[model samples]
Target: MIPAAAWGYQISSYPGTGGIWLRRAAVPHTGVVMPDDTDPANGPTSGSASSEAQRRTELGAFLRLRRERTTPEDAGISRGTRRRTPGLRREEVAQLSGVGVAWYTWLEQGRRINPSVQVLDAIARTLRLDRTERDHLYRLADIPGVPLDVSATQPQPPEHQTILDALIPLPATIVTARYDVLAFNDAYAALDPGLALLPAADRNVLWHLFTAEEHLQPLVEWEREVSFMVAQLRAESGRRLGDPHWTGFIRQFSETNGRFAEIWARHEVASSVTRRKSFWTVDGDEISVIATGFAMASTPDTKMWIYTPDDARSQRLLGLLVGRYQELGPAELLRRGARTGGAGRSSAH
Candidate 1:
């Protein structure tokens, strides 16, 4: 919630985020790396990883912001006559939280140190953080619970598929923390090749952005959307620290997609959010969609994305796209694709 989990809350052609993340984006990787997860999901890595560094930086900023907002009187501390600091002092926060002053100072400086859960709890108490703030703190600290609701990551519950289909004209999909498309409706497939039309292996938001040959053509705000997407990935990495899935995913693209590799090196982090985006249809139609993200309390490993048109014109355009897909249907489209020997490639083919 604090790292802007609803996401610095944004916009694009689509808003089917789980908040608006992948579906509506026009193109390019956001170049954000999940932070401070060098611990590796199974084992720990050096504290020097870029993502970890970025997480630490965010943690420090969050702490400082909270600290600044809290006053001495608010913390039940006596305001001495000669007070100069606007809020409680660093030592005061450290002392109240039962942590070392130097350590807290380093934490604020964004140093490469791990803050335990207990310590974070104490700090949270000292800062009087609310539930959302507390969650954001834990995430930035790279604590294990940051991923939230770690359950079965695959073959999403049947009900979820039903929900996506029900969304109708809206494009929607379910995505993993790492941006893998778990499930999507026909509307989502209508958006692009990777949303649902592509083979399961290529059904990843990051993968499509990085490897799709014609990605640049569809994306209008390549830099902004790409940066936000990467930031989301970076924030999520904090939770999957040692998971091989994340490790392999990053490594594979780093080697296969040069631009992705370059952007991944940036190690950016962002909170999950909802927003609008615009994309160029294969027929050269420009459609703006609102992307919204919803959390699945039933499972933390997955999220739902729903995309709505941003205006009447886009709505009509979406209906047209949906009508085309409905007329042929995914199966018919697939069959046609196979006949043309372009089944797994982009529909634009």
Candidate 2:
């Protein structure tokens, strides 16, 4: 329901009839739209505020334009010649982007549409947009193109890398607050073979735990572990509503993991980080380990992860993973908490 106050109502509902007659009204589009000047009370009048509305209006137009620019051949549809339109048909775009034809129509008609980054990205991909074009599309839609906390979304800073190396024999790794595996010692890679095979972006621990069903499930203590992971991702996601990367990740996972989708939909957020977590290895060895996450002094996204064993058996397990460790230089230590690395590393795991 539109806000009653926006419609100049002292109290909601009609005084006598109790019918929601003048709750807030939306005037039809008129000539010329500007930004931030329209009477928001009148419900989207044709003035400057309409400019924002126009920008939204252009989202539909731009989507349609993008649709019209591509050919049937570009989208792998058959062309019998004697064509009229310059681009693919509305149906073609709907089919290609995995959206409903009616829904796409409503979108192109500019009906208060706010698409998730993943949906917009799918449309962008269907239109064969490059990075710059994709970025521009996001700007026009008034949504973030990438994660807002880019610093928090990245791998380790240089100083953190040194810390990871120093924790070498202990099988230490560096990850972002969101569970991105930024860097790891040789020992960590040896202990977790899957870590070595993943692309840098897929090194995100949360992505693996959430999306890679086969890889993590066997090792996970489902009742508590899964719940904890879900809670952690839930909290991180809340902190990044406008972040493009997080938006895309959530959409993808929501489709793939129904349980995760359900939990995320509840709007639960948990920042609880305990000092310890226990796990059983594939070899039937139960390891009691300490899990610590330190906030980056400079870069909020990056942190050093050190796994210290609580017992001799776990310490022996660490020895089997890597050799002796060494401390990093002073310069490497200085870059520890700052956002380092580049853009290519920011994609969803």
lDDT of 2: 0.59
lDDT of each: 0.69, 0.59
Best by TM-score: 1
TM-score of 1: 0.52
Q: Summing lDDT over every window of 10 consecutive residues in candidate 1, give the lowest-scoring window.
A: 22-31
Candidate 2 local lDDT, residue 302:
53
Q: Candidate 2 at residue 43, lDDT?
A: 64
Instruction: Kindly report which residue stretches of model 2 are placed more than 4 angstroms away from their true locations once superposed.
Output: 1-158, 211-220, 323-349
Cα lDDT tens digits, model 2, 119-146, are 6767887898765667678778776334
Please give the lDDT score at residue 164 for candidate 2. 70
- How many residue pairs clash in each candidate at the backbone level? 44, 13
Candidate 2's error at 152, in angstroms? 12
